[model samples]
Every structure is written in structure tokens, then in C-alpha cells.
Target chain A: MNVPLPNADHLVGIVFLIMIGLTITGGVIACNANRLVRAVAGLVVCFVGVAGLYYFLNSPFIAMMQMLIYVGAVAVTISFAIMFAAPEESKKHGPPGTLAGPFGLITAGLLFGGFTLLALKTDWQVHAKINDGSVETMGKLLLTEYAMVFELISIVLLTAIIGALIIARRGRSS
Target chain B: MEILSLYNNLNTFLIIGALLFSMGVYGLVTRRTLIGMLIAAELILAGASINFMAFNRFTAPDPQVGQIFTLFIMAIAAAEAAIGLSIVVAIYRNYKSIDAEDLVELKG
Candidate 1:
């Protein structure tokens, strides 16, 4: 096939690779950091990268939601929780179990290897399109086909907020 | 060369999802505190969402389904983080420590 030398696709691919790097680095920091706040920061970076991935997957709406929900709502909530409840440095000096870290690493590596193999070997099937999966169609489906779930999720969020308030405010009156 | 074309391949996304999942597993297993575990849980959710998005992009007939599913996952994750963090606060209040190992009051 005729093509330009080092085309636009190559630039997009390099950007994709950079996103992958950012994602993995964020994940590593989130898991391996010495402090909790740093882990939350890493989680934010990772979620941003994942949002970029969603954009590449042809779901800009989902990407925006990922950014709003994960990076905006979830990460911020986790950081607030850390601020309120994280243990002080002075209390963390006790010796930890020696085997826990190494064992966890080995288990994660094995799991990763198995999953990679499964993903590579599996013969995924493709089907004909019902719709173009556009924003307008998604909105229609969300209101029509998936209306019940949409409503239920709202209820769930309401309950979560209420429950969080009750639980966090339990001991404050003393 | 051909390596740059990896972005269009489903396998690439799947492998990335697997790696994210493994990182979550490692964090969950190794983290000593409840918030740390929660962070890892979010990572796991993210990986699952990526897998869904990949399959949606590559194979699904109704691509909206996976996007919708991923949105639901995000909603659930938001709820989970809220409830979990509140519980974490409660636990810290009761036990004065957020470490998972310190939560042995019910071990008997």
C-alpha cells in the first residue's frame, strides 16, 4: 500500500506509547510510594492516562466521565480521607512482616503472565453493529433501554453520600 | 515501523489492562492500610473498564453497551470510594490506626 514516509499515524502511535508509559509509571508510584498522599497523586495521573485511552477507543464521553468521576470525584475524595485519617509518621515505625512484599510481588507477576497469555490466545468474536454508538444514541439508550440502571445509580450515589455523612459524623459530637 | 500500529490492535489494550490489573493485585496484597487497598481497588476497576472499552471498540455490535457499562462502573466506583472512605474514617476513629493488621478486634 502507498503511504507517506513516517505519517500522522506514527505520531499518534508515539503519543499512545507515551500515555502507556505515564499510565504504568503512575500505577507503580501508586502502589510503591512511601506515603499515602503521593499514592493518591499517582492514582490521579493514572486515571488521566486511562481517560486518554478511552478517547483513543472512540468514547470521548466516557473519557470525560472518567476524568470527572475518577480524577475529580474519586481521587479528591480519597485525598480528603487521607487528610482526615492518615496515620502519623511517628506511629508507623514498627517492623513489618518480611515476606509480605516479596510474596505479593510474585503473585502479581504470575497473575499478569496468565492474563497476558489468555488475552493473546483467546479468539475474540466480532458482531454486526446495532448502532454507531454515538453520543446521541447513547443518550437515547440511557434514557430508554437502560433507564432503570441510570436511576438506580443515582439512588446509590444518594445513599452513599448520606451514609458517608452519618459514619464520618458519628464521633464528632463528643 | 509496524510496532506503531500496535495502537489499533486489541491485544495491545488487553495487555495493558492485564498489567494494570496486576499492579492492582500487587497493591492490594502488599498495602498495609485500608486507603491503600482502596486505591488498588480503583486500579482494578480501571483495568476492567479498559477491557470493556477495548472489546467495545473492536468487537461489540452495540458499542454503546460497553460505554454504558463503563459509566456504570464509574458510578459504582464513586459510590464505593465514598462509602469506603467513610468506613476508613470510622475505623480510624475506633481503632486509632488505619493499618489492616491492626483490625483484629473481631479475629476471635
Candidate 2:
């Protein structure tokens, strides 16, 4: 029996490269853009690309969840924040005393170079699989092994929702 | 050595994760607005997720565990975003602007 290899065709390879490009470009735009709204837009693009990477990682369920939660919900929330709380234009380019563009670039470059070296030099070991990482397996584990954490997360989400409403609703009689 | 075939390697994903993380660091430090910093923080979270997923695909014995961890990270990020945005709104309501520099009453 022959198992088919993923991304063996050249077309998938090209698409992977394109997704990488999109991720990098979107990250640059999100971080470096002058306007806040544009930065949010960039973030949406970046999250979409990250979802694509999840697909490539052989986790389609996670990929769809990534797109739904991050790109769809989180990005929309940030854009809404931008619309409601648009920052002032005065001295928007740089803060008062902290380091600016070049220093940031240098620092990020050093970090990137260091991490790349580490990744390339280290030999990652593979282990035997317990399951095929299918959606069914994930669901079963979510209810069996990780049920407590799942319930706790729901509670946390509820608390966050209430806390947000209370904090934002205060001091309204100005 | 072949760039096109990089999709098949664990190191490739690790390198990309590292890049995303460094970009987040850069954005966090250089951004002057609250929203920009939040966006950078999201990038950092994404980088961490990618790292976990990469390790899961290549090294971990149980792949579902990593996906579970990533799902939790997504949940935490969502809650953080909601609370952070609400705080930003409150700050804007009080100061009439969302610039980090303007909200410096507690400065030493």
C-alpha cells in the first residue's frame, strides 16, 4: 500500500510560498503602518495567512477555527476599537523618549537572526503517534481529558464579558 | 537548499514562527498607540501557536494535545482582546484620545 505524500506537487509548494509572503507582508503592514485602521487591516491579513499555515500543518479543524475566531471575530473587534477610539494625530509617528524606527528594526532583525540560527542548528526528534490528529480525536479529548479546562474557559469568557461591560459603562455622567 | 520544498520541513515553520515573534516585539516597542500594541501582542500569541503546532506535527507523540493548547490560546486571546478593547474605549471616553502618551497621570 502506498501512502500519498502531501505537497508533493509543485502547485502546493508555490501556494505555500505565497502564503508565507502574505504573512510577512501583512505583519510588516500591521507593525509599521502609520495609521491605526490600516494596521488593523494588516492584522486581518496576517491572521488569515496564519490560518493557511495551520491548514498546511495538517490540522484543518484548527485552521477553520483560527479563521473564524481570529480573522473574523478578533480582527473585527480591533477594527471596532479603532472606529470608536481613534487616536489623536498629534505626534503620532513616534513616542516622546523611547527608541524609534531604526532601533526597532535592528532589535527585530537580531531576534529573527538568532531564532533562525537556533532552529536550523537544533535537531528536532520525532515521536510515535498516538492518534491521527483527526477532528473526532480532538473532540473526544476535549470532552474527556480536557473537560475541566473547557468549562473553566467558558467561565472565564463570561467573567470577561461582564467585566468589560462594567468597566466601560462606568463614569458616564461626565 | 530548495526554497520551494521548505513546506515539508519542521525548521521552516520554526523559522517563520520566530520571524512572527520578532515582528511582534518590534511592533510592541515601536508602536505609540494602544491598538497597535494590542495588534503586536496578537502577533506574539500567533507566533507561539505556530511554534506549538510545528512541534506537534514533527515531534510530539500526541498531536491533539497541541491543537487543544492552541485552541485554549485562541480563547485566551479572544478574552484579552475584549477586555483590552473595552479598556481602550473607557480610556478614550475619559481622555478624548487613545494615545498612550496622553494617559500619563501616574507618571513618576
Model-by-model DockQ, in order: 0.71, 0.72
TM-scores for all candidates: the values are 0.92, 0.90
**Model 1, span B1-82: residue lDDT tens:** 7788777888989988999999999899888888989999999999999999999988987778899999999999999999
RMSD of each: 2.8, 4.2
Error of 2 at B2 (Å): 2.7
Quality of model 2 by C-alpha lDDT: 0.86
Model 1 ranges off by over 4 Å: A1-6, A87-95, A126-133, A171-174
Error of 2 at A51 (Å): 0.6
Residue A11, model 2: Cα distance from true site in angstroms: 0.6
Error of 1 at B85 (Å): 0.4
| Candidate 2 per-residue lDDT over residues A1-174, each given as its tens digit | 574455556667878888888788889898888888888888888888888888888888898999999988899999888888884542476543556767878898999999999998987786655336599988998999999999999999999899889878866586
Which numbered prediction scores highest in DockQ against the true structure?
2
User: Distance from true position, residue B60, model 2, in Å?
Assistant: 0.6
TM-score: model 2, chain A: 0.84
- Over 4 Å off, model 2: A1-8, A87-91, A95-98, A128-131, A170-174, B106-108
Error of 1 at A74 (Å): 0.6
Q: What tens digits encode model 1's per-residue C-alpha lDDT throughout A1-174? A: 678677798998888888888788999888877788988999999999998888888888899999999999999999998888985732452235788788888999999999999998999774544335479988998999999999999999999999999988875558
